[model samples]
Target: MFKHFYGDNITEDMAMKFRNAAVALNVQISPAQVQGYLLLRKEDPQASIDDIATITYCK
Candidate 1:
C-alpha cells in the first residue's frame, strides 16, 4: 500500500518528518506505525501529515 506511493525508498528523513508531524498532532506513534500514516497520506495527498495523524491516531 505505502509502496504504491513511495516505492521502495522510504527514507529516514521521511520517517522523521512523519514522526514529527505525529508528535505535533499528539499521536502516540512508533517507527513501525509510520507506514500506516503514509497509507493515509496516499489516500489524501491534500492533507497535512499532522491532519492525517490526528484523524487516524488521535481519534
Candidate 2:
C-alpha cells in the first residue's frame, strides 16, 4: 500500500512520483489511475498499474 509505505499524508508531488514510477515501469496509466491503484494497493499490493493496463487494453 502506497499510503502505508509512503504514509496517509501523501502530497501531490508524492503522488506524481508514484505515477512516474509506474510510467518508468512501462505501465500505461494516468496519474488518477495511479492514485487509484495506490489506494487499492492498501487493500491488495498484487493489484497494480500493470493490472490496470491489462484491464484497460482488454476493454
Model 2, 27: alpha-carbon shift in Å?
A: 3.7
- What lDDT does the true structure give each of the candidates? 0.53, 0.51
Clashes in model 2: which pairs?
A: none
Q: On residues 1-59, what C-alpha lDDT tens digit does candidate 1 reach at each position?
A: 33345655665555566446656767456545555556656654335344654545622
In candidate 2, position 38 carries an lDDT of 58
Report the number of the highest-TM-score candidate.
Answer: 1
lDDT of 1: 0.53
Candidate 1 Cα RMSD (Å): 5.0
- Per-residue lDDT for 28 in model 1? 59
